[model samples]
Target: MKRRKFLKNSSLSTAGIFSASLLASCETDKKPQVVNKMIKPIVIATWDVLNATNKAWQVLNNAGTALDAVEQGVMIEEADINNQSVGKGGRPDRDGNVTLDACIMDKDSNCGAVLYLKNIVHPISVARKVMEETPHVMLAGKGAELFAYQKGFKKENLLTEKSKAEWLEWKKTSKYQPVINIENHDTIGMLAIDSKGDIAGACTTSGMAYKIGGRVGDSPIIGAGLFVDNEVGGATATGVGEEVVRTVGSFLIVELMRQGKTPQEACEEGVKRIISKNNEKLDFQIGFIAINKKGETGGYCIQPGFTYRVYSEQGHINKTASSYISS
Candidate 1:
């Protein structure tokens, strides 16, 4: 009986070993999971920028670098005399000066910015020159304007009759009201991943309509207005600059993506970070747009009328982002 018992135990042990070996073989044969496979050649931007996305897609489709694509794309908007929120048509500050702010970032982490730069119809291009030709990362006011002129950037009268007329009307009350969803202060912050899967970004704005003179928003501040990490992703912001600057919103989104959050999740969290510190009602608007290395994109805002544009092989579309307050 004892021998029979030992034989039974040995048979059970043999069966267990066979099962273990079979399981190991099956596991070894299984395919490794791939997360968020890379989708090359995509572009995203804040607000209704169909033309800008099309311009960017034109470059990416032609095998241009991400830096060149983003820089060129926003230039279209920057040059648009009808775009009152940026560049040529941007509304003036309280002092009736058309000060533009812009920044650019390349895949290699090189960045450049210009603030309170007046008479430049394409501050985005000037910012690019700063990134490419100068030793400094930022130049402001008269210095920035002089650098732009030195780089052969022609000074132009950016304020248009339409914007100037509005400024005159605004001076009537001189009220310091910042209207959410107005689109008057809409900034064009753009991101692109080229066919090579490298990422770059640009943000350009006339700044908030009727903002105090000499006030610099997040639009031209690296890490606050825009951030790019070739191994991770890139992010850009629009809306009120102070709130975005306070939270380091664009950088926060990229870091969140590095920690494995989806682009949409990262954008949502960035907006929430602002809400978390609030002691009063949210009467202002703030928006963020992000794209991961995988070419997946996402956006979120504090208020409605926040939309982002996308152009890829999948086609161009303007998507309204989910807002924190509406939720």
Candidate 2:
């Protein structure tokens, strides 16, 4: 009986130790859970509502960070000469040179850019370099190209045969079209949120067709074309370059959030503000897309029959063709 009782006591002690170890492990796991709950997740937004945002959304959903997603999405626009007015056969300046510009920013680091670049196959990469490597906020024209080349960026002949043909045709006909220049002011504006919950934005464009020699649009202008703040989200603008620049369109929309306006409200109000002040010819239109920290988004266009593409959670590469109903 004594031996049996001793064995029973030994078993009870072993079980008690195991229970204690299990309890300790459970507590260890709980600590991380508690910490994770305290961390805030990131949100993102882009212009063009669902259509443009969708590309970046897919990248983020695939575990890409917001910056990477934004660049990838912007590349889609750059390569799509047929779809976007920013590059390739879309348009060229009076001299028939394709001057391209792009800029990107990450709210997590407060990085920003303004690049007046030319002959760059990937202006977005140059903008990224400005945000990451240099102390300066902008690089312009040939200077920007030189900087990019120094960074080991290879030169790409941005002009396609189709683009050349268009320019040659323009030289031949040079028809003076009236107001409402439909041929100019179309590019891709994109923003996104990564799985890690960071916000980023990018804008890319080949400047308006028949623009002045050496003209650079607002695409590379940080506040005018693209602006991002992880704290607030991001915004990007498209349309008449001069109008967008003068309005400081993208930053203005984001700033509205600082004043307690929703993303959609901000975008609408920004467009309204521009329209109210500008007395210029009415043919050119303007628009913007944005996302806020809450994952709410907004898009607005000043021109009729304006539509945009978006990539998002509910929508993957959704191209929503919309009309600008006069308010």
Candidate 3:
């Protein structure tokens, strides 16, 4: 009987030891699997995208929101010296006049835009204000400038010596008829999602080089050239001013996402819609990029070499330059 009691006690002791070991193993595994509840840093960027990557890193590291980073980054592109086709020194259209416009949107709040504005150096800032302060979604032309002026925005000489020289040369070539038809003007657009997973976008341009005074392209059209929806992500486009204006490419991309397409597929569908139309002979190339909530991103251009930049949570910011050298 004593022997039996000893065997039972030993067995119980062994089982208890095994149970403790199992519990210790579970505790060890649980430490690593704590659901990674740590907050991620913010992310932001603009399409200027080359060294702008560092700027995005700076903003994210500092805890700036994704929208703040994107707008700031695009502002950098607008202010770039050699960007020639966007803001300040942009190429003119057939006319010698210069106009400017910009737009920005945040998917987080479902509120944002600036449209058909002129003489305003920083349309995106105005757009953010309109979204945040005023009840309206868009402000345009003189009214836009008036609002900007009232808000203490200082206007500068939008026309630069280089742009003027180009205008004069074209005028000389056309005997100042103001009917020189040159194509291939470009613009700037940026779309981004930060580590925090919020989305934002901006588009800016000096009006089509020599476009008629007060002419506005898709650049300032909210859904036309730029759009952001946190549920899906965001998108922005540039190139072929008129075609982009007419097709509403940016909103179309979001709608494509609504229809269950990937960001790249949505971009392709938007481009296809522009191409398959039998009605219009589009003069310039249009290019766009999109990022969905899943972090799947895609871009397309109707022109052969169309490309844009991208910055996201998983990848560092980089420019993917492209154009439509062909059809």
Best by the lDDT measure = 1
TM-score for all models, in order of appearance: 0.86, 0.78, 0.76
Error of 2 at 225 (Å): 0.9
Each model's lDDT: 0.91, 0.70, 0.67
Residue range 245-272, candidate 2, lDDT tens digits: 8888888999998788887788888787
State how far residue 70 of model 3 sits from its true place (Å): 1.4
Query: What are the per-residue Cα lDDT tens digits for candidate 3 across 180-284?
Result: 232434566666656666667777777556655656777778788888887776777776656766778888898889779987788877777776662445455
Better of 1 and 3 by lDDT: 1
Q: Which residue runs does candidate 2 get wrong by more than 4 Å?
A: 1-55, 112-114, 175-180, 279-281, 317-327
Clash number for each model: 0, 15, 14
Candidate 2 lDDT at 57 equals: 59
Clashing pairs in 1: none
How many clashes would you count in candidate 3? 14
Best by TM-score: 1
How do these models rank on TM-score, best leading? 1, 2, 3
